[model samples]
Target: MDPSRSEFAIHEAAREGKAGVVDSLLNANPKLATQKDDDDRLPIHWAIANNHLDITSTLINTRNFDPDTPDGSGWTPLMIASSLKDNQGEQTVDLLLQKDVEVNAQSFNGQTALHFASSKDNLDIARKLIEHKASTRLKDKRGQLPLHRAAAVGSMPIVKLLLENKSPLNASDVDGMTALHHATSEGHGDAAVALLKAGAETDKRDMDGRLAIDTAPDAKVRKFILQSAEREGIEIVTS
Candidate 1:
């Protein structure tokens, strides 16, 4: 068999997540296991990304696949799992983690698994990542961390978990807007309150010198801010 032809077979098996085909080919030529496709995705990336748990298991356990292989987007199996939107994704994530995959690994966005998990509002996955000491301090391209993403989406459970994990509630984005600022501007009263309760400094102004209260979308939210400020004994001088 031509070596290039064998490489093509390996690539096909990898893309289809056919562990048996991949194993057969790999066994015939062990070097084929390391071959990458055009997108630089190894067989392991496809198996995990497609939720082929059996293939993934075979690749990891029997074939000793590298868990950290990055696809075209610099997304490892763990990073891809973090972005999963269904129970199968959850299962895949859990399986990978159980195999001791690097839980806090970052993606092209500079987001740890926790950041991506929170982006999907998967409390179970979020909790699992947090429990593994997934870095809450990591910021994505937007300079927003996992906690900021959770707060923006009004994911109460994930926000709570992130707060419990000591995520920086006051961490600001490029424009100097904190999670509380985002929550307030978007009229997510509960999320705003959560951030404030988590000790997010309400008085911290944004780049435009607007506090969280000034960004409230409506009077009800404005009232909540005023009340909260009063309760916290913070002074707000407004015209």
Candidate 2:
């Protein structure tokens, strides 16, 4: 294959977990190791994105391999790994973290790996990120903390982890909506219960001046919020 074709081939090999092909391509053109594809993604990004652990390792070992290099959308290998599921994703994350890549690196949207982990309900990944000192209080462009993302996605385990790590239960977003508001609005009764147990204020209002219970998607969620509020010595006032 031509040298230019080898460049594209390396990316394809990385994506397909073809470590031998990647090795040959890099050997043919050493600079291909750091070359960016059309999407501005290096071979490392492709390897990690596809959960090709061996290929990822080979790419990371290359000279000048920047694990924190952002793709066209400003997504780092860490961020991409966080968005994956299962043990492969976890292993990829561990590899990146071990390289001392920026654990709190944000994407174009200002979303950190913790934000992705929380939104995806990857409890173990979230725990690892927290252990690495990923700030739970950090917000995205929308001013949403990891806890807010977890609540919006109905990730009860993630919500619990964030709260245990001192994430503010009542932390509001740009819309002035807390995790409780997201939980109730999404009709996640279990998530709402978790937020309430963590002391999320039910009376807190969003930009629309609507409380969490007011946004409850159904009677079941409303009833749960009201009952939980009562247990916290708060009254639910309905007009």
Candidate 3:
């Protein structure tokens, strides 16, 4: 197979997990290994995006393969793996980390692997990224921290992990909404409780002057946050 004719074919093969085809294409022209498609994605990006571990491994081993190269959207292989929803994704992440890829590489949207892991509520992936030194405090384009993403998604375990790693508990976003506010607004009572326990300010308000308690999605959530504040000896005065 001519490498020029197989450009799209190679990417498709990787995406579909046809390792043999990818190998043939690479052997035909080693330069094909680093060629980008219209999406600015190499074979490796397609393989990682589709959770094709074997194909991903093959592509990463190719000479001059830029593992950290972002696609058209500025999403690195690590960032793509972090956003995956399967154990294969975790394995891909492990492989990338082993290769010493940038643990904290950001996308065009300024989202890190930790940000993606936290937002997706993938505790295992989040833990691995954290262990690899992925920053928990790095804010995205929205000025939202990983803690904010975890809280918004009601990821209590992730929230706890970030706190243990010294994530800023009361850090606010572009909206001036902290993790506590996100938890409350999303009706994540357990997340709210965890943030409060981690020293998130209950009285902290958003740009709208809405307190964390004020954003509670329901009465039950509001009551839970209020009770938690009472126990923390913090006053919950809403303006």
Q: Using TM-score, give the best candidate's number.
A: 3
The reply for model 1, stretches above 4 Å from the true place, is 1-31, 214-239
Candidate number with greatest lDDT? 3
Candidate 1 local accuracy as lDDT?
A: 0.76
lDDT for residue 210 in candidate 1, whole number 0-100: 92
| Per-residue lDDT over 1-239 for candidate 1, one digit per residue giving the tens place of the 0 to 100 score | 65436547766666576677877786777766666777787777777667777776666664546767777887888877777775356777777777777876777867777877787787888878777778788888879989888877778888888888878888889888888888889887778777776777866888998987788889998888678767876555443
RMSD per candidate (Å) reads 3.8, 2.1, 2.1
Candidate 3: misplaced stretches above 4 Å?
1-7, 228-234
lDDT against the true structure, per candidate, is: 0.76, 0.85, 0.86
List TM-score per model, in order.
0.79, 0.92, 0.93
What number of clashing residue pairs does each candidate have, in the order they appear?
0, 0, 0
User: On TM-score, who's better, 1 or 2?
Assistant: 2
